[model samples]
Target: MKEGIHPNYRDVLFVDLSNGFKFVTRSCVATKETGKAEDGRELPLFKLETSSESHPFYTGQQKSVDTLGGRVEKFRNKFAAFKK
Candidate 1:
């Protein structure tokens, strides 16, 4: 491993806007804002729309798919008539 040329890896806070969930993890991502975490540790605060806590997959929430009017399916159905 080389030194001085690599990005600094430090603690970063990922805050989910929807659920107000905050978590600290080590990352190379830089941010201007900083705040003390729930554990009383100072970390960079980064705002995000979705995180593992509020994401549909991780939260086990049923997501509604808008496949009924997909353009690809419509095109395939339209071309299916010519296949016969």
Candidate 2:
């Protein structure tokens, strides 16, 4: 309820640096850049490295891991020891 003591809350863009993805939403987050997204004329744009488009879960490209490695058996043995 105070005046002149609050940060300016406004709409801003959130950009994911890893995949060049960007989305517009109302947020208090501050940034140096500004832009307008008009209703009906706006189309949200986003780019992602894994968005069910190239992910193994969606594409059925899952790979099986070898469980015979010393690390794997060691971990299993460690848990088995605790279980006993």
Candidate 3:
């Protein structure tokens, strides 16, 4: 590994907006915000809409609609006119 040729990889804080869950881990993701951890250490902050903590799939709260009339049909109907 060479110096100065790789993106800055360091610890970053990820916050889940839905549940306000926060965690810090190593990452190279870019952010314009900063936040402090529970220990009072500041780290680059990245906001997220869904994470394993709040995701329906992981939480077992997911609802399944009949594919015949659900998103698949809605999407096909929405763009069907483009086929002509």
The C-alpha TM-scores of every prediction are: 0.72, 0.36, 0.72
Cα miss at 56, model 1 (Å)?
0.8
Q: State the C-alpha lDDT per candidate.
A: 0.89, 0.58, 0.94
Local accuracy of candidate 2 as per-residue lDDT tens digits, 22-41:
56666666455544344433
Query: What lDDT tens digits, residue by residue, belong to model 3 across residues 31-56?
Result: 99999988799999999999999999
Alpha-carbon runs more than 4 Å astray in model 3: 1-5, 69-84
- Residues 1-67 of candidate 1: C-alpha lDDT, one tens digit per residue: 7778988898998899998999989998879999789999888999999998888898899688988
Model 1 alpha-carbon drift over 4 Å, by segment = 64-73, 76-84
Better of 2 and 3 by lDDT: 3
lDDT of 2: 0.58
For every model shown, the clashing-pair count is: 0, 0, 0
User: Which consecutive 10 residues in model 2 have the weakest lDDT in total?
Assistant: 39-48
User: Which sections of candidate 2 miss by over 4 Å?
Assistant: 35-84
lDDT of 3: 0.94
What CA RMSD would you report for each candidate?
Answer: 3.2, 7.3, 5.9
TM-score of 3: 0.72
